[model samples]
Target: MRALPAALLLTAGGFTAAVAQQTAAPDTMVAKTISNYSAKYMDAECQLTKGHYKVSSGATYLSTAIERGSIPENRLRALASGRRVITEAIQQNGQDKNAAAWYYLGRIDLHLGDVAGADSAFKRAEALAPGCAQDIGKYRRVVYAPIANKAIDFTKANQNDSALVYYRRAAAWYPASPLAPYNLANIFATSKMDDSALVYYDATLKATMVDTAAATVKIRNQAGYNRAVLLTRKQRWPDAVAAFQQYLTWVPDDADAKKGLIQSLRAAGMADSASAMEKKLGVTAGNPMAPAAVTGATADYNAAVQAYNAKNFAAAAAAADKFLVVEPNNRDALYMRARSYVELKKGPEAAKAANALLAVDPMSETALSLLGAAYNLTRSSTQAVNTRLRLNALPFTISSVTAAPSGA
Candidate 1:
C-alpha cells in the first residue's frame, strides 16, 4: 500500500476524531437526561427511541416504584411526569404504529385512574403490536386487582351500590377473569335482583369455562347452581331443570343440588323422574303440591299468619317454611308464605310457594295473582304476561267482586 501524504493523513485523523466526538456527545447528553428522570420513565422512552434517548418504561414500573416509595406526593409527581413523557412520545411519533408508546400511555392512564383512557390505549397497542398481548394482559390484571378488592370490601360492609360500581369497573378492566363477575352475580342474587343476577352468573360461567383452576371451578359451580335456582324462581321450569342437572354434574354429592334438581324436575312436569330421585335421596315426597292428607301444624301455621298480618314478613316466611315442612299441601299456609315473601320482595321464594299452590288448585285466582306479582318482581315479563292472561280468563265470582254499584 502507498503511504498517504502528511496533510491527508492528519486531515483523516482529525475527521475520525470529530466523528467520535459527535457520537460521544449524544451519549453523554442521553445519560444526563436519563438520570434526571425515573428509571421507569426512561426505560419506555429509551425503548421507543431505540435506546438513543432515555425515557421511562410502562406504567407498571412507575406504579411499582410509587408503591415502594410509599409517598403520596411522590406518586403524584412520578405519575404526572410519566404521563407527560409518554404523551410527548405519542405526539412526536404519532400512535399510528408505535405500540410501545401506546402501551406506556395505557399504563400511565391506568396509574392515573383513567380506566376508559387506559382501555382505549391498550386496544390501540394491541392493534399495533399483536405480540404485546401477554404484556397487556399482565398490566390489565394489575388494574383489576385493587378495584375488585375494593368491591369486596364494600360488599362485606353491605354497601351493595358501591360494591356494584367497583365490581363493574373490575369486570370491564379484565373481562377474562371470573372473580368480579362471580361476585357481582352473588350480590345481585342476595339483593333479589334475579334477572341481573342471571346475567352476571352467565358472565361468570363463560369466563370460567376454559379456566380449570380450583377457585374458578368453584365459582362456576356456584354460579351454575344460583342460575338454576333463579330460573326455577322465574318459573322457567325447563331451563331450571337443565341448569340444575348441569350443576349436579359438577357437584353430584351436594344434597342441596339434588333437592334443587328434584324440585325443578317436578316443576317441569317430570314427576316420575323427581319421584325416583326423591326415593334415592330418602326423601318423603319431592313434590310439595302432591295430594296428601293435611297434617297437623296448627301452632306453626297460626304463628306464620300472625306474623304476616303484623307485617313482619321475614319472620312470617320463616314460620310458614317451618309449617310447610309438616303440611306442605296446606293452602292457607302456602298463601300466607307466598304473600309474606312478596312483602319481603323475595320474588323467587314467593313464586315457588305460588307455584305449589297452583299445582294443588289450578283454578286458584289468588295463587295466579301472586304468581303474576312474583314474575313482575323477578322481571320475567313473558311469564308475568302469561300469568295475567290466565288470571283474566277465570270466571267472575262473588269473592272476586271488589265493589257493588256506586249508588248502591
Candidate 2:
C-alpha cells in the first residue's frame, strides 16, 4: 500500500502513541521536538534550546486540523502545549526580537481567538521585521471586518463604551479605513465630548485623504464640517474660520455651513467679509427673528442703543437689524444701525443702512447728513456732494444735526 500522508498519520493512532511516549519526560520531548523541527525546516538551531516547538508550520497544521475537527481535542492540546513552550522560550532566551517567533505567536493567538494578544504580537513582528508588514496587514484585515461590524452593532444599540473599545481596535487594525475613526468621532460628538470628537474627526479626515474613494468623500466633508462646528463652540474663532472655509470648498452651497462660516468670520473680526457674505447669501444679520411685536421691538431698540453705547458696533448693528425685522420703517433704529456701521468703518454697510433710513424719512436732516458721511467714507465724492446738497435743501430746525462727525 502507498504511504499515508503525514497529516493523516498524525491524526490516527500514531498521535496517541507519540503522546504516550513523551508523557514520561514531557519537557525533554518538547526540547527535542523544537530542535528537530528547527533543524529540518529552518536549517538553523532552535533559538530556544529548551522550548517545546520552534516550527511555525507545525502550529499552522495543528490549527487547521482543529478547524477541520480531526481529533480536535488532540490538536487543541498540541496548540496549548506549543503556546506555553513559545512563551517560556521568549522569556528565557529574550526571543522577543525574533520576528519569526513573534509572527507564529500572533498566528497562534489569532487561532485561539485572543484578538488583542494577536494584535500586539503582530505589531511586534512587523516592527522587528519590516519586510513582514504586508503579511501582518493581511492577517489584521481578517480580524478588522468582524470587529468593525461588532462596533457598528454596539453603536446602534447605544452601548457607546463597548463600541468605543471595538472601534478603537478596528481603527488600529486597519488605519487606512476612515469608517472606524469617523464613527468614533460621531459617538464622541453625541456624548458632548467636543475635544475628543475633534481628535477623531481629524483622524477620519486624514484617513479619507489617503483613501480617495467616492464614498469617503461624504465622510470627509462631514468630518470637516463637524470639526469646524466644534472649534466654533470652543470659541476658537480663527481656527473655526479656517475649518469652515475648508468645508465650504467641498459643499459650497450648504446653507448651514454658510451660516457657520458667517458666524466664525464675524467672531474672528472679519466683519467686512462677513457682511459681504451676508449680502451674497441674501441674509440679514440674524435671519429668522421672532415675529413682529411691540415688546420685542422695544427690547431690540434698547439692545441696539446699549450695544452702541458699549462700542460693540457689530452687536449694535445686529440688534438694530433685528428691530428692523419687526419695525422696518423705524427711523431711530435705522439711524442707530447706520451710525454703528460708520463707527465700525464699514463704509458700504453704513451707506446701505443710511439709505434705508433715507427711504423712511427723506427730509430728515440727520439722515441726509449720515448719507453724506457714508458716501465720503466710501470715496464717492460726487455722491457725497449730492448728499450734502440734499441736506442743505432740508429746512433747518433747532434739532437738525450738522453733517455726521467726519467719520471718513
Model 2 residue 344 distance off true place after TM-score fit, in angstroms: 51
Clashes per candidate (backbone, < 3 Å): 11, 0
lDDT of 1 by residue, 258-335 (tens): 767888888889988988887665555745333233234545666777787778989888988997786665556677
What lDDT does model 2 reach?
A: 0.65
Encode model 2's per-residue lDDT on 217-238: one tens digit a residue. 8567767877898899889999
Q: Root-mean-square deviation of each candidate, in angstroms?
A: 19.8, 23.8
Q: What lDDT score is found at residue 47 in candidate 1?
A: 26
* Candidate 2 accuracy as TM-score: 0.54
Error of model 2, residue 381, in angstroms: 71
Report the lDDT of model 2 for residue 364. 57
- The reply for model 1, stretches above 4 Å from the true place, is 1-94, 275-279, 282-408
